[model samples]
Target: MKRIALLGMPNTGKSTLFNRMTGGAARVGNWPGITVELLSGKILLGGDMVEIIDLPGIYDLHGFSDDEQVVRHFLHDNVPDLALVILNATQIERQMSLLLQLKRLNLNVVVLLNMADEAKKYGITIDSKKMAEMLDMPVFLLSGKYGAGYPEALQAVARALRYPTPGMAEQLRSQLEEDAHLESEMARVLHHAVQIPVQMPEHLSDKLDRVMLHPWAGLPLFFGIMYLLFQGIFLLGQPLQLWVGDALGWLRGAALEPAVGWLPAIVQGLLLDGLYNGVATVAAFVPLIILFFLFMAMVEDSGYLSRAAFLMDALMAKMGLDGRGFVMLLMGFGCNVPALMGTRVMRSRSLRLLTMLIIPFSLCSARLQVFVFITAALFSPVAAPLVLFSLYLSSFAAAILTALLFKGKYQNNEPFVLELPPYRFPTLRQMLLRGWQEVSHFLRRATQFIVAGVVLVWLLTNLPPAAAPGGPDTFAGMIGSLLHPLFAPVGIDEQLTIALIFGFVAKEIVIGALAVIYGQFGDALGSALAQQLDWVQAYSFMLFTLIYTPCLSAIATLRNEAKSTGFAAFVIVWSLALAWLVSFLFYQTARALGY
Candidate 1:
């Protein structure tokens, strides 16, 4: 299949366009010999199947950022037949320089003035016909968000595919020169093809930014919004979780129990208590995961996520990072594995390593499930969201402390630059797709680890034939007992300690291990947990989970991205020490406070 590359500066609606074009059927894979991931999808154009590769959004073809270098290398090594140079219509005046850079590389390019609708809203207009004539290429006014002129855009691509641009890839490395007059050339093109209102009416984005980005109120408002997000997730997801739990219970009783009833006692125990109870317990949190991702998608697609980063840049700099690192940290909220991968955007090794260290501290959705379960079981409904929000705050606190402590060792000299797109309403389809992707990723990446961890926990709690399950003589009990003294100061009991051990594989398994530990599932598991520990112990356990070692997948990604086993090991060790220290202090202080 012929290859077409989607290239654009960051926040130019490149990803939105990719999703629109590919219908969210894109698959992410690494570029050859490079650790950077590229999203590719196939679509038929004019009876020909062509692949669309969404390259990393970069500001310049020759910029020093990791993404920019990746783009340059990919173009040189595997040049696409056509590069769709997407430019944000509202910012075309400035973004046109990137297009000039690509042209200098001798790549066959089609200029897509994306977000035409938003441009019109800003009292800006682009004459695509004039632009096409001026730039000697096809220029199409398109809105990637709402599919305006989408069919025409595809038709243009189909037409361009017929006339393959030869010698374009070969010229990439040799022809890339410092275009000193590129600014004047872009100005010449824009002067003819674009019009901007001198007295442009104030936009809703501007009106909102005045307050949302205000130095005094921005940080507090960001936190308030995040707090509400958690509250909303709990309020909306609690009943759904209950329903899922009940459904799982009914399935176990109605189908699984009968299906496995004829098996031997040992086999039944493994299948039912080990697998069903464990997997089902974790599966019950799926609703919250979906809701959380959806909320994050809204924040992201609305363009406020970048604003959050901008708002935090000052504070982040103090912690040896920037707004961009904080954005990756926020992405870690969805999953640390990808967030760790995202650190590749930083050019400096120290910056990437520091960001990698801090990202794992994000209370990912996996840990979110554990916190949601614990908070629901221990705290009142009114206090549950508060408790969950506190965990999030603590996660950031842990990340900040880590950055401050390690800033000297891992120094970042690179400057921070980020694009803040205009605020717009996120389409329902986009939000749903984000939720689906996150939930699907959670299930696909987590199922094996969760099942294995829970089964191991089950075996550890049920082995030796003569001992009672989860009793002192069982393997789990023995291990947990051995470590109970060390954990006791932090409010972790033997059973919870066993769960923590399994949790190292994947945090979702923490809930599953708990199910196995208590010899219960669904509502019974929650009730069992409530009986096992008070609110203070439960909170302490959450703090420990929040700061403890990241999952195996995250550790592996850290090793790969940091490219140093020693650094990865240090991360694990430091996180472990921090977890113990924080939990011990919190438990001791809470006890001292007579709570």
Candidate 2:
């Protein structure tokens, strides 16, 4: 199999092109770096199994960083038959530097002019054939996001790989080895191979960025954007969330509820109450997950996400991260899996790890749901929003504190530099596909873990033949009793403890599991919770839930992104200790003040 390495500077649509080529069939593995991984896939192109390797995006391969070194070493050690370099066509002048550098590595090269549509709107036109002639490589003008010109490019690469040849890599290297004029030579090629209108069309992105990238106005605008984002998540996701639960309920009552009566009580408990309920619990939140991702994908596709980072670079630098890491942290509000993956945008290992660690504190929509449920149930309508707002503030505080503590400890040498792409309108197809991809990845990774957790909780709550579900005689009850003295200071009890145990599976499941533990449902469940716990304890429990742990999927991501099980375990321990300390202090201080 001939291997074609996909190389590019970051944010050139390399990953999108890779996904299109691989049909979303990809596997990830760490090479030498603990923070980032190599993405590889096998595709049957032109009746041959071609391995498509998506190498980490680096501006200059000769630059230092885990990603730079990783790609550099991979090229030297395991030579690819061909290199397909994706470049942002809007900024071809600066992007061509990497193409020139690749020729120095003596590898066969093909230039992919991505985002051609955006470039065209800027009155930029490129002569692909002429550019290919001057650069001594194949240049394909296409938009990776829209599936434009892909089939022809793939076929060309397949044919080139099938019929080996001594290409211009050697000839160019000999001419430019020590010439130190790669930039001038690149400018010369663009001079003949491209044309631009004397008076360019007024770019829409520049007008938007003028306000969005403004130091004074940008922060407030960003906050407004986020405020609206939450409003959408709640307005759109909540009703669908309820519909999902109602649908699951209807299915249970109409189908499984009757069938379970015929099975042995134990089997019924395992299936209906345990496995089915557990899976359904997480499944109910699917609407929120999809809506959140849909909105995020829109922001990402419009290229506003990069601008958000560029706007926050200076403020974020104090915490030992760049605008990109902060952008990843902001993404954590939607989902942590993609947020962890987003850390790939940062080239430094330390920056990626620090960003990943802070994401668990992003007050993700899942956790937000739990906070909303508790605050609404415990506080008056006038106060509930304030209470929820405070919890969100707490999440941000914790994230910033975590970043400060870890920033200097694992500092890396690479300075953050990002190119802001022109913003374009997000297509419906792109939004839907991006949303589905994230939701599917979340379901695939989280379902089994959640089901197993549900069963484990069911067993602990219903063992010994006499103990009622979540009763005082079961193993969970006993464990809670033993640990209550320590937690009692923070107003924790067996029921809340059991909910927390399941909450570790997924934060959104906390409310559903609480309903199970209390044997209550619908509006009655809130009243039951309010009766069982006072407002102070209720708020404390919510705090503990918010800070204590990342969901199971996040833990798995931490392991993958951090590249060590030990680091993942450390996150668990650190979060648990911090949650305990924070909640204890909050409760104790409130009590001291007679709240």
Candidate 3:
């Protein structure tokens, strides 16, 4: 099988192109010595099996960042038969630098000027034939999103395999000297060969970007969009949540309850009561997750995220991080695992480490359930949103403050160079496919960890008290009491402390523990907790949950990425210490204010 490597800058639709080529069957693994994943897959072309490797999206090979190193090593060590350079056509000038570097490696190369449709909208044109002559390789204009002109690109790649030409060794030396001359030559060729339309289509995105990228208006617009997103999630999820809850209740009563044997009861409870119900609760948020991703995809596809980074650059700099780092932090709100992995986008080691260190403070989606369930039980509907907003706000504040304190000399200005792809209507098929992918991932996790967590909680909480006289004498009670003092300063009860302990294994398990411990409250726990605990205590719990040590998997990822066990240990201890300190301060202040 012929080996082919796909290389490009981040967010250049490399994944989309891979999915298009390999039918989304790529095996993603961490690149050697880096947490950034390397994607590999096989595709059959003209009865020949080709192994395709998708290298990490990188800007330049000169950087010492994990992603850059990954691409650099891969190219140097296991040279592929063909190097497919996917360039965002709209930003071809900047992307060409990487192409020149790859050319210097004396590898067979094919240039894919992707996002061609978007380039046209920007009054930009690329002459593939002319570009091919200049780069001394085949070049094709294509759009991965629209699936246009891909076949030609693939055929060119296949043909390149048959005729390998080596470039002159001195070409590398000349490339540095004549970069400006080469660009001018390429531009002149494009002018003669490619034609622009008399008038470009007017896009709503342009109008939106005008407002969204405004220095004074952008922040407000961002906040407004966020508020709508939260409201939309809650409104859309209520029905699905109730339906799943009712279905679980019916299944539990109808078949599970009638089982006479102990084995049957245990089996039924484990499968239906524990796994099914637990998964259903999490799955109920599918609509919301899908909607959020849909919006994100639109922004990404339309090339607005780059502009967002540009607008927020100053604010991010104030926090001692760059604009790109801000995007990773924003992603942390959706899920910390991928967000942590996304830190590969950062070019600076200190910046990436600091971002990873603080991401645990972001209010991830799993915690949203806790917020909604608890707030609804304790306070009015309006109060739930307000409380949730405050929790998210607190998390962001904490992240920024931590970054500022940890500011280091590594903070250097790297221009946020981004390609703004033209906006297009999102395809329903794509959205549904992506949504199902995430929902399936969530279901898998629930079955694997959450089911076991529920059973474990049931065993711990329902086990008979030790025959010894005191409450602390019981096995579970003793365990809870032992951990309670550590959490006491934060106003977390023994039960909540136990949940936090389980959360260290997996955050979702905290919900499972709560369900088992507080299920007797029967869906009213949220309102009940609000009434039972003061606002101050509720806020403190939320704060602690946000800043507490990440799950075991996250710690493992941190260890793997940082390449230092001591650093991982530091992350665990530091996060816990910070969580304790912050929660304690909030508790005291809130009490002093008599909340």
Candidate 4:
């Protein structure tokens, strides 16, 4: 199929447009020369099936950042049929430089000035015809978010593809080149075709920024927002989580158990007691994960995410990171794998490595699931959110402490630059889509690990035909017993020790492993856990989970991205050591306090 590449700088609504064009059917795959995954999907335009590849958002094609190199290499290797460059209309002046770079690459180009509505609201208007004439490319105004002028832009894409730009092949045969007068050319086009008010009316975002970006108030406001975020997740998701758990319990008792009743005892144990309970336990948190992504999507699309990054940059700078690294760390709240991969955006290896080391402490959804379960089981409803929020704070504290300790070792001198986009309310569709995307990602990637980890735990606890399941005679029990002395002061029992070990594969499996270890499922598992540990111990386990090693997938990504086994090993060692020390101290102190 013919190909069209979606190219743009960050915050240009490129992703929003891609989703609208492809109807959220895109698949993520790594291109031949690209290390990171890119989203590509097929959409029919004018009776022709064409692939749309969404490239990473980059500031400059010639820039040395990893994303820039990926874009540069992609254009060199894949050579898409047409490059549909999207520019933020309000920021068109600076964004047009990327369009100029693509032109130098001799690719057929069509430009869409996205967020036209927002631009117009700022008293900025562009004459598309004149701009098209000056730039020698088809230029159109579009609101990728609101669907304005999208039809015309689609038709323009179809026309550009139907009739390949003349002399393009001849230009492709020539060496890739650069133009020095990009700024002049862009200025000339803007002078003839765009109009901006001398004193533009102030925007609502500007007024909000006065408060949101204020140095004194911003940090507290950000903390408040995050506090509310956790509370909201617990309040909204608690019922749904309970309902999912109850449903799974009903499934096991009413359907799965009876259907497998005729099977052999080992088979039954493996199927029901191992696989079913393990996977089901992790699956119960899907609702909470969805709610989390939904809230994050709102914060992201509303443009407060960048504001938060800006708010944290000063402190981050002291830690040898910048605003962008903080953004990646926040992304870790969703999943550490992608956040680690996101470190590629930084050109500085030390900075990326530091960010990767810290990201694992960001309280990802997998750990969130475990924390949610523990907090709900151990604390009163009024205190549950507080406990969960405290875990989040501890995660950040751990990350901050890691940064402070390692800042001098992994030095980053790169200056921080970030663009704060205007705050826009995300549509309900966008919110729901983000939630679904995260939920789908979790199911596809984490579920297998959870199921496998739980099954492995079950076998370790049940194997050797003569040994009682999860008893001291079983392999897991023996191993946990061996390590119990090390963990005993921290209030982690032998059974919990095995769960922590399996948790290295994926934290979501912690709950599942607990179920298998206790020979319980769903609510029974929670009751069993409550009986096994007091509030202080439960909180200590959470702190350990919060600060311990990243999952296997995150570790692999860290190794691959850092391209250093030694660095990855260091991350593992430090995270584990810190986790143990923190948990041990907390458990010891809390016990001394007689809580």
Candidate 5:
């Protein structure tokens, strides 16, 4: 099979193009030695199967970032027969630089000036034939979104496969002989062949960026946006959460309660109470996850995300990080696994490490259940949102402080170069598709990790203690005892400590453990806990869960990205220690205030 690679800079519609070509069947996996996932698919061309690999979006191959290195190694080692270089037509000047570098590799190359429709609106026009001659390869103008010029682009690929031109190196070297002359030649050709009208609408992005990136107004704007996003998540999710809860209760009483009666008591409890409730809790968050993704997708597609990054650059620089790192932090709100993987966008090793270390602090969707359940039960409805916001603020503050501390020791900083794509209205099809994808992922987690977690929590909490004295004497009680003292200063009881410990395996399991534990003691557990556990203790539990160890998948990804078990181990240990300390301080301070 012939091999082809799709290469481009970030957000240049590479994934869109990949989806267009492969019908979204590409297998995605982390590239060797990098956290950024690579996408690959096989396309039939001219009655022959051709493998297409979508490389990570990168600006230049000279960088040391994992993404850059991944591309560099693939180009050097696999050496694809053809490289389909996808460039954003609107940003030709900067995009062309990568194409120039790729030309030096001497691969059969085809240039795809994607997003041609948007480029034309920007008064940017590229003469395909002229570009082809300039680069000594075929050029196809494509609008992947609209499926324009797709057939021609595919034909160009097939032609390249048949002809297999190996003249790119010589062509590139020749162009370098007279840099000014070469540019003039290309410009003259473009002027004659390409006609872009001057009349166009105002770039709405520029107008928005002016205010969104303003020093004084930017921070408030960001906070407002975040507040609205969470408000929508909470408000929209509440109905669904309640509905799911009621449905689960009905199912448990009407069906599961009677169905499991013939089974042993332990087996009955594990299935009816543990597994069933765990899946229900995770399912309840589906609405919130969908809402969060919709909000992010709107921001991203509207081109505000880049402006947000630009506004954050200076603040991030104070911590030896770049504005791009902020994007990863933002992603953590949706899911930490992707957020951790997003650190590949950060070029500096130290910055990547620091960002990864702090990402767990960002309240991931998995932890939203813990927050909502606890706050809704303990605080007023109005106070619940405020309490959740405070926890989010704490996480953000902790991340910034951690970054600053790391900067003091390792001060390498990379420039945050980003392309602010022109703002446009989002298509309904795209929004719904993206939103559905996130919701599907949430449901999958419910079935895979959450279901099993519920069963385990049910078993642990229901199983009789090897020695009987108190709650701490049970199987889970014993395990909780081992880890409980570390959280004593944080006001976390043995039961909560056990939940926290299990959270490292999978965050969704925390809620399941709590459900089983609280349900096991029935009325006694709640009344006794209410008397013993003060508001400070509740606050401390929330804080600790927010900042503590990441989910198991995140740890595995860290190991893959950092390429060192030691680094992953350090991250796990460090996050646990910091969470404990921060929670302890919060509890102590709250107590001192007589809360």
Candidate 6:
């Protein structure tokens, strides 16, 4: 299949356009010498199945940064049949330099002036006909978010693909000599093709950013927004979660129990109770997972999330870390594994390592599921959101403090640069596609791992023919019982201890493990916990789960990406110690307070 490369600077709606073209059918993979991922999808274009690769957003093809180098190598080594150079329409005056430099290559190229709605809103207009005449290429004015002119854009790509290109090595050499001042000169020349508004009217995004980005207000405002998000997850998501949980239970009873009964007792128990129950328990949290990702996707698409990186830069600098590190930490709230991958954007190796160390502490949605589940089951509506929000704030506090301690240990000397996109209303199609992509990704990556862990735990708790399931003589029970004295101070019982052990594989399965061990599911499982533990111990348990060792995949990521077994080992060791110490302190302090 022929290839179409989507090229643009960061936050120029490149990814948005990619999703619009391919309908969110993206595969994420890594190429040589870079840990950053590449997104590509297959789409039918003009009677041919074409591969569209969304290259990393880079300002210059010849730039030196890691992301830029990836784009540069991909372009020169694996040159695509056509390049769709996407430009932010509002910022086209300055962004045109990138398109002009690529034009120097004399390849078949098309300029996609994206974000046309926002551009028009800003009273800016682009003469695509004039631009096409000057650049000797097609230019399409459209909104990637709103799906405006997408068909025409694809038609243009088809036309661009039909053309054969000539070498421009001499043109490239001349351009390279004048590259330093190219941006200003390009802006000056584009004056004929673009018109700007004088005395620009204030934008809604600007009005909001003034408060959201204010030095005195940004952090608190961020926290307030986060509190509401958690509230939404519980308040809005609880009904959906309950519905899903009840449906799964009904399916298990109506179909799985009867279907498995034909097998031998052991097979029936393993299939029905072990794997099915475990998987179902994890699946129950899918509602909240969907809700969180939906909220995040909308926030990201609207572009206010980028301002946060700027708002927190001073705080990050205090810890000798860069704003990019904090941005990766924010990404972790969606998924820690990808957030770890995002650290590749950091130029300094020390900063990357430090950021990698902090990402696991960023309260990923998996862990948040456990927290939200606990609060929804154990606390009042008014108190549940507060507790959930506290957990989030605590996670960030711990991550930042830990980064500060390691800041001097690993010295880094790279400056921070980030693009703050103008906020706009993301289309419902874009929002739904993003949410579905995230949900599918989670299920694809996590289902097998979680089911396996659940079955393994069930087996360990049920083995040895003479012992009862999860009883003292069973493997997990024996192990947990033996460690009871050590765990007792922190109020971790055998069932909870066993659940924590299984949590090593993935945090999302921890609750399912609890349900299996106690021979319960859903609300019954939460009821069992309520009967067994008091408020202090319950809080302590949540604390430990929050700070415990990174999940198995995250640990492997640290080892592979940091390329140091010792560092990965150190992370595990320190995390375990911290989890225990913090849980112990919280439990003890609560008791002393006479709660």
Best by TM-score: 4
Rate residue 572 of model 4 by lDDT.
Answer: 91
**Candidate 2 lDDT by residue in tens digits, 147-257:** 888888887788778756334343222133544687788889989998877787878777988899887999889867866665666667756867777788788889987
lDDT of each: 0.88, 0.78, 0.70, 0.87, 0.74, 0.82
Q: Write the per-residue lDDT of candidate 5 for residues 1-595, one digit (tens) a residue.
A: 7888899888788877876676645665544544357768888888899888988899875666677777877776566788999988877766676776676667888889998988877787678887677678788999887878999899888888997546334322212344565466556545665665666467767787788888899989988888877777677777776676667677778988888899987677667667765666556556666777887777766677777788888888888887777878888887888788878777677777877877877888778877876776566778878888888898889888778767776667566677777776656655665566555665666567766676676667656735432366677787888876676777888888778877888887787667666663222333445665666888889888988888888898878877789888988888888888898888898889888
TM-scores of the candidates are 0.96, 0.86, 0.84, 0.96, 0.86, 0.94
TM-score of candidate 1 on Cα atoms, chains taken together: 0.96
Clashing pairs in 1: none
Q: List clashing residue pairs in candidate 2.
A: none
Best by lDDT: 1
Residue 246 in model 1: lDDT: 98
Q: On lDDT, who's better, 3 or 6? A: 6
lDDT at position 100, candidate 2? 82
Off by over 4 Å in 5: 1-4, 20-26, 30-36, 41-52, 61-64, 79-82, 103-110, 129-138, 146-202, 439-448, 465-470, 520-535
Q: Lowest summed-lDDT stretch of 10 residues in model 3? A: 167-176
Give the alpha carbon lDDT tens digit for every residue of 1-595 in model 4: 8999999998899888888888877788888867778888898888989999998899977778998888877887788889999999998778877787677666788999999999999899899999999888899999888788999999999989987643334333223353557677878888999998888899999999999999899999999999999999999999999999999999888999999999999999999889898888888898999999999989888999899899999999999989887888889999998898888878888899889889999999999999999888888999999999888888889989999999999998877878889999998878876677778878887767877888898899997879988889999978988999999989888988898998898888899899888888778888888988999899988898889888898999899899999999999999999999999999999989998
Tens digit per residue, CA lDDT, model 6, 1-595: 7888899988898988999888999988766645556888999888889999999888876776677777776766666789899999988877887887888777778889998988898899788888888777889998888788888988989877777644345422312656556766686557888889886779887888888888898989887887777777788888888889899989988988887777998877777778877788778889889988899888777776778788888888888787777778878888888788777677788888888888888888888888877776788878888888888877887787788788898788889877787777777888888998898888876786788787888898889868998789999888998889988988788888988987888887888787678777778777877788887888888888988897898998888778899999988887788788888988988899997
At residue 300, candidate 5 shows an lDDT of 69
RMSD of each: 1.9, 4.0, 4.2, 2.0, 4.2, 2.4
lDDT of 1 by residue, 86-131 (tens): 9989988789988888777677778899999988988998899999
